[model samples]
Structure formats: C-alpha cells, structure tokens
Target: MNENASSDVKAKRQILIGLSGGLSALADRMRSQHAIATKITTLAARAEAIAQRSWDLNKLNSQDLQRTMDGFVGEIKTFAKQAIDAAVRAGSEALLGKEVAEAIAAHSAEIARLTREIDSLPDAAAVRAILQPLSVTLNTLPARLKANTAMLKDVDAIGALATGLAERGDALAAGGTAGNRVAVELSRDLRQFAEEATTFSLKMASEAALAVKAISDMAQRTLGLSQGNPVSDQAPSATDRLMTLARTGPQAGQVWATSVSRTSRSSPVQGTPPGVKW
Candidate 1:
C-alpha cells in the first residue's frame, strides 16, 4: 500500500508541470497579439494626420495662385494706361495724326479690358486665348507707328513712348516671385521690346541730326532693362549676343563686322545667295 501511494504522487506532480508549461505559452501568445494591435493603431493615426495636412496645403496653393493672377492683371492695366497717355500727348502736339492716336488708344483699351477678363478665367487655356490676340496687338503697335512718316519725324515722341512702355513692363515683371513661369515670360517680352525699340531708335538717329541726344537717352535705358532681366540661364541667341556686343562701342561693331565677313567666306555654298554670283 505504501508503494502504490508513492506512484500516485509522482503522476500528480507530472500533471501539474504540464499545466504550468501550457499556461506560460498561452500568456506569451496574448502579449504578442496585443503588441501587433497597438502597432496597427499607431500607423493608422499617422496616415490620417498626413492626409489632413496634404489637403490643407492644396487649399493654400490654390488661393496663392489666384492672388498672383490678380496682381498681374493690375500691372497690365497700369501698363496700358501709361502707354495710352504717351500716345495721346504726342497726338495733341501734332507729332502724329489724330487718327493714329485714336487707334492706339482704342487698341490699348481693348488690351486692358481683356486683361481684366483674365481674372474671371477658369484655367490657363482660357487665359491663353485672350493673351494670343493681345500679344499680336502689342507686337504690331511699334511697327505700325514706325511705318508712319509723320510719327518717325518726331524722334522725341517715339522715344517717349518706347521708354514708357519698357519701364512699365519692368514693373509688371516684378509682380511675381522667382520660378514663376508668367514672370519669366513677361521678362522675356520686355527684353524683346527693348531690343526692337533700340533698333528703331538707331535707325531714326541716322536720319535726324538733332535727334542724337534723344536717341542716346532711350538707348541707355532700354539697354539697361534688357541686360538686367534675363529670362533664363541658357545662352542668348546669336542675334542677341551680337546686338549686345554691338552696343559696347565702334570697336565692338567692327569686330562683329569682321566675324560676319569671315563666316560668309568660310560657309559652304550649295547655291548662290540672292543678288550674288557663284
């Protein structure tokens, strides 16, 4: 009977050991599941916060773009007003025909009105539609005025108009921050206008003896504007490069002339140029 009791006690101890080991493994699994649940909650909260911030940023950017557009429109109106005033003054002085002055004022008014309409545009495409005709009008104005004999006779009047337009264009270009595509394009347009005005001034200067002083002043301002505001980091076109060089002095002009002659001689000719023999 004593031997039987000893075996029963050994079996009971073995059953207790098995129960303890099973309970320990169950506790470990519960802890692992709790850790995984906590990690999932943390990641979800982080993602939600990021999404909210992104939405706010998009709203701010949209507001900022509208403000920029408004500022650009204001500058354009100012530009049109000043140019119109110059043309009207010249007309009153009999430097150009009254019809010409009326035409200029009419064109400028249309440009200003169109510029105001840009504020109501829904997207870039609509704005570009307005800008297309506006650009053509702006580009053709100086040439049209230059074609009139009466207008070209008064060099001072032409100089006044050119300089005024250029100054206002510079101001308009300053309305936006760096990296803004609109500002960069406006700056390029200003430079091109300056170059064309300078060319016109030089051509008229050759014909008028007493107009030297007016031409000099206009050249100085326009050249300064062109040099100061570059649209990009890319190298300037060959025409622009030579134009800049030609502005320095007579010596620079001579150097450009020599280079042109050399290029002409060295270039291979597939056919004779117009008004030239083979």
Candidate 2:
C-alpha cells in the first residue's frame, strides 16, 4: 500500500482499539451497576415485607406505614442517585467526556419530575402504587444489565474485527484503492459504534434512574419531608430516617425470616388473633 494509505489505516486501527477499550470499560461499569441493582431490589423487597407485617399486626397505622415507606423510599432515592453519579463520574474519568454529563442532567430532570408525582401520594395505597412498580422494575435490572454487558462485548468484538482488518491491509485488499475503501468503511463503523455507546448508556441510565426516583419520591412524600425545605428537628429527611431504620432493619429482617421459616416447618401455633406466633 502507498504511504498515505498505510497512515490512514494505522489511524483507523487506533480508533478501533480505543472504541473497543471504551466498550470493555462500559461492560465493567455495567457489572458493577448490576450488583447495585440487585441490592436495591433486595432492599425494596425487605422494606415491603416489613411494611406488610407491620400493617397486618397493627404495629403501625396507615399513616405511620406510609411515613415508614416514605423514609425507605428516600433512602433508596439517595442510593440510586449516588450510584448514578458515581458511575457517571467514573465513566467520565475513564471512557467518557461530555456525553455522560448530558445524560446525567437529563436523568436528574426526570427524577425531579417524579418527585412531584411522589408528593401526591397521600396514603398507604398511594405509596404502594409507586413502590410496587419500582420494585417490579428493579426486579428486571439484573436481566437488563446482563443484556447491556453482552451488547458492549459484541460491539467490542466488532471493533476488534475492524482493527484487525485495518492492521492486515492485504486481508481486505491487494491494492491501494481497495485499502482506501476498507479504511473508509472502518471509519464509518467506528462512528456508528460510538453513537451506539452513547445511546445505550443514556437509555440504561434513564431506566434505572426513573424507577428508583419514582419509589424514592413516594417514600419522601409518605414521610412528610418537604423537598424544598432543609432537614430540621421536627421533620428529618427521608434519607436520615431511613439510615436510622436501616441500622435496625437487618436484624429485624433476620428475626422475621427465622420466624417465618420455623412457622413454615411446623403447624401453626395458636396465638391471639392479631399476633404472629413464632
């Protein structure tokens, strides 16, 4: 191949390698996000179970239950936001630039909008309406992350192919003209791959943010925490309350689980109508 053609192929090869590296990094991010999603899902389930048990045993009134749900939701919202911010920051530092900043702003706007909707949830039923859908969405997160990771891998493979083709000029063509055409096609493929990555990241972040925001907003409203106001003595923020509850919730969940297991194995123990027998 001519000197100019060889230089062009080398440049395209570099681009392909860079693209593949970005995809690999994104796949790693998705793996980490998948773990976060799994934890959120488990947290939602535990909170819901605790709410149900409290309600059934009349340990909390409807309003109180709503408040508790709000607190948990607040905690989740903070968690989700932190996760997104961290992921975006990490991506920006590693594989991204302005692309992630735009996406983060968009997701933040959506979360704010959902917060208004969550504020309208006045009762336990309303709280459940928001929480249930979020729980369901979070339940699907593992699958979504798996698919995204697979997609990144597939794109990375394509980049590798393009890089290989660029490096081995004779593999695609015997002459300068053929080599030029291969370079043009490889450049086009790189552009398309970059666009796909941007789009995919935006979509993934949007879905995760929206689901968590919806539930978090609901919980904040239930707890009567004013979004516009700063946290104070009378009305602590949902995240704050959730932190307090979280300290005890794990032990409570463990006890509840043990009680449930024992009951499932044995005949129902006679108890007062309203109390659960362990």
TM-score per model over all chains:
0.22, 0.24
Top model number, TM-score? 2
Each candidate's root-mean-square deviation in Å?
Answer: 39.3, 31.6
lDDT of each: 0.33, 0.34
TM-score of 1: 0.22
Q: Candidate 2: worst 10 consecutive residues by lDDT?
A: 255-264
Q: Which stretches of candidate 1 lie over 4 Å from their true place?
A: 1-63, 91-187, 201-278
Q: What residue pairs clash in candidate 1, if any at all?
A: none
Whole-structure CA lDDT of model 1: 0.33
The total of clashing pairs for model 1 equals 0
Residue pairs of candidate 2 with colliding backbone atoms: 70-219
